[model samples]
Target: MEDSETHNLKRETIEQQYKTVRERTSNFNSYTSGGSHVMEYGSTSIKAEKIYLYQGFDPASVNFPPNELSHDTQMEAINQRDADILFLWHMYKNSEDGSKKKEILKQISETMRHRIHLDGSIDLIGTVLYGPAKGSVILNTIREPGLPLVDDWQCLKSMVRLFETHCGSLTQYGMKHMRAFANICNSDVSQSAMEEACVAACSSSHDPTQWHPSNHGYSA
Candidate 1:
C-alpha cells in the first residue's frame, strides 16, 4: 500500500510538470506533442514579450480612450471619417520618431482631406466625461448629425454591433501587424482572413447621408 501511494504521487508530479512544459513552449509550431497539444483559451502559456514585440501595444493604449465606446454618455459624435482612421492617425503622430510621425500625419491628413471632398463633411462627434480625478473622451462614428433623440435599446444594439464589427476589426488589425512583425523576425506567423473581413464590413456600414457639411447646415 505504501509503495503504491508513493508511485501515484510521483506520477501526478510528473504529469503536472509535463503540463507546465507544454504551456511554456507551445507557441512554437515545432513543439507539438500530438493532436492534444493545442493551447486553450485563458491559457497563460502565451508570452507577452512575444505578442508585444510582434504587435506593439493595444490600439487603445497607444491612441487613448479608443474610437469605439458604449452608449452610456450624454453626447456622441458622428463623423464622416471612420474611427480607425483617427486611431491610426493618432498612433502615427505620437510615434517615437519625429520624422516618421510627420510623414504618417501628412498621409492621414491628406486622406482625411480627400474624404471630406468626397463626402462633403468633416464633422466628428464625441462624448465628454467629467470626473474629479480625471476626465475621459469616448468617440464613435455617428450615423447621423444634430443629435436626434435615440431609443435606448436601438442605441445599445447599434453599439453592440459596432463593437462586434468595428472594434473587432481593429483588434484583428493589431494581430495582423503582429504577424507581420513576427514574419520580419523570421517566425512562421501568417496573415488572417479577419483583416479583409473587417475592412469590408466597416466600409459597408458607412452612410452617405452622414457626410459632413450638409447643405442644410452650411453652404459649400
Candidate 2:
C-alpha cells in the first residue's frame, strides 16, 4: 500500500513520462525521400517537401491572378513565416519578464490565427499554445495591414523572446530543412511534396517554435 503523497508523485511521474513519449512519437515514422526535408525519430520518418518551396520564395513576388493566393501557396507561406516568427518569439521569452512573455505569446497567437485563416488549420498544439491574444492580433493585422495590430517595437520585442526560447540552438541543417519547407510552400509543390517538407521540418530539429511544421504535412 502507498501513501497518498507517494501515490500522487508516482502518478505525476508517469504522466510526465507519457507526455514525453507522446511528443517523441507524434511525428515519428512519418518520412518521405527525394525531397528537401526529412523527419526521423527512432526508426520512424516523415517527409516534408512543401515547406522547402515556401521558405525559398518571396511572398510579395507571388502573383495571384486577381484572387487570393491558392491554398497550397498560402500554406507554404504561413508555415515558413511562422517558423521565423516562432523562432523569434521563443528568443524573447527567455530574456523577458513573465508578464512580457505572456504578452508576446498573445501576439504570436494572433499572428498564428491570421496565418491559419489564410492557409486553413495549422498544427493543433501550436495553435492552442499561442492562444487567443495572438489569434486576435492576426485577425486585426490582416484586416488592416498598415494599421498596426501591436506596436512594431512590441512585435520585435516578442520576436526576440521567441528566438531565445525556441530557435536559440537551431542547427544549420535544421535551418536548411525549415527553409526548404518554406520554399515548397511557395512553389507548386504536390501534396506528397508538402508532406515530405513537413516531415523534414519536424525531424530536422526539435524547437518550441517549430512545433507543428509536420502537423499539416500529412493533412495535405
Candidate 3:
C-alpha cells in the first residue's frame, strides 16, 4: 500500500497525523524489506534492509523507516526473505528526466531479481503505487514495458483504507483528499468505462481523473 501527497499538507499537519498513526496503530508492524527509510507503526519501527549496491544503485532503496537493523542480522534473515507484497514508488510523468527514470527502474528490477536469487525461492505480489491523478498514466506505461501494475480503482480503495485507518487525524484539506478517494471507490466504475471517459476527455482536450494490470490476472 502507498500514501502521501507531493505537496498538499503543512509540515505541522503532516507531523500531527503521522503522530496519530504511530500512536494508534501499535499492533501493526510496518516493514521495508529492501527499503532503507525510517518507518514506524505504533511503538515498532522497521527499517529497510540495506543491500550491496549495483554500480552504486540500490534497487530496494525506494525509501524506508524508523528502525535500524544490523548488517549481520539482515544477512542472516536473507533466507527468511519475508516479503509477500511489493509496492514501487513514483511515476515517469512526475519525472523531469524520463530516460534516467527508466534507467533507474530497470536497475531496480535487475537488482531485485538478483536479491531474490540470493534469498532463495520466493513469490511476490507487485504493484505500482502512486497518486490518483497520475494513476492511469502509470498503469499504462508500466504495462507497456511488460511490468504489471495494479488497477486504478483497486489502488484507490487500498489508499482510502490506508487514510481512514492510519491518517484519519489529517487536516480538513487532507481529509478532503481522502474523501475524494473514497468517492472514487463508491463510484463503482469499471476500468474499461473509465478508459472510455478518459478518451472522450482527451478528444475534448479536457483531462479527467488520471490514471491496470496483467494477464496473470487477479484471483479475487
Candidate 4:
C-alpha cells in the first residue's frame, strides 16, 4: 500500500516539512544602511530587493541566484480602474435627495472614495468602512511614520488633519473614540455637518490653545 517516500511523507510532521524547506535558505542574512536619500528606504525592503535582484546582487563579490520576476495570478488586465465603486452604491440606493449626495461626493477626496465598500448591505457600512486598509485613512493617523513598531501611512493624512481642524487634538482617552470618527466618515453627512458634529462633541474636552492646525503636519 505504501512506497518508501510515501510512507516517509505519511509519518512526517508539518514541523519536519517546514524545517526541511527552511534549511535551503538557512544561511541567508541581510543588512542595510539607512537609505539612498532622506525620503527613501534602504535595501531590506521589496522595491530595493527587486532592484538588487534585477541588477544581480554583488554584496562583497559572491554571485548568488537572482530573483525571477513574479508571475503571480495572471488575470484580465485592468488599467486605472476605480479601486472601489460600490462604497457609494448603497448610499445612493437609499437616499432620495440627489443634490445632497453629489455634494457629499464632491467634498470627499478622490483617494478616500476608493477605500469604501458597502457591497453586502446598508447595515454593514460601518463594519466594511473600518475593515483592514479601508480603515487606514483615519486610524493610521494617531502614530507617526518611522517610529518603532508603528507604520508609515502618509496617504490618509488629510482626513486626520480635518479631524484636528474641527475636533481638538486627541489624548489617550480621546483616541478611544476612533471608531466614532470612523462612523462619521462612513455616514453620508456633508462636510459641514461632519465639522459641526466634530466640534460639538470634541472641542470643549481639551484646551483649545494646545491643539493647532500646524501640529497635524507632524513636523513636531
Q: What TM-score, over all chains together, does every model reach?
A: 0.20, 0.20, 0.18, 0.26
Which residue pairs in model 3 clash with each other? 35-48, 37-64, 37-65, 38-64, 38-65, 38-66, 39-65, 39-66, 135-211, 136-211
The backbone clash count of each candidate, in order, is: 6, 66, 10, 0
Residue 153 of model 3: what lDDT? 52
Off by over 4 Å in 1: 1-80, 120-220
lDDT of 3 by residue, 29-93 (tens): 33233322345455323222211221133334335333232222321122122221122225433
Task: State the lDDT at 146 in candidate 3.
Answer: 57
Task: State the C-alpha lDDT per candidate.
Answer: 0.34, 0.34, 0.33, 0.37
Q: What is the lDDT of residue 48 in candidate 2?
A: 22
Clashes of 4: 0
- Against the hidden true structure, what lDDT does model 4 obtain? 0.37
Ranking 1 against 4 by lDDT, winner: 4
lDDT of 1 by residue, 172-191 (tens): 22222222122212221112
* Top lDDT hit: 4
Across residues 141-198, which tens digit of lDDT does each residue of candidate 4 receive?
4434664322222322333445555544432323444444444444343455545544
lDDT of 1: 0.34
Give the per-residue lDDT of model 2 (tens digit) for 1-220. Answer: 1111112221223333333333333333221221133233552121222222323433443442321223222111224534656675876767567877777777677555434432322232123323445532332223235643333443333332232232232222223223222322233334443344334333333333433323222111
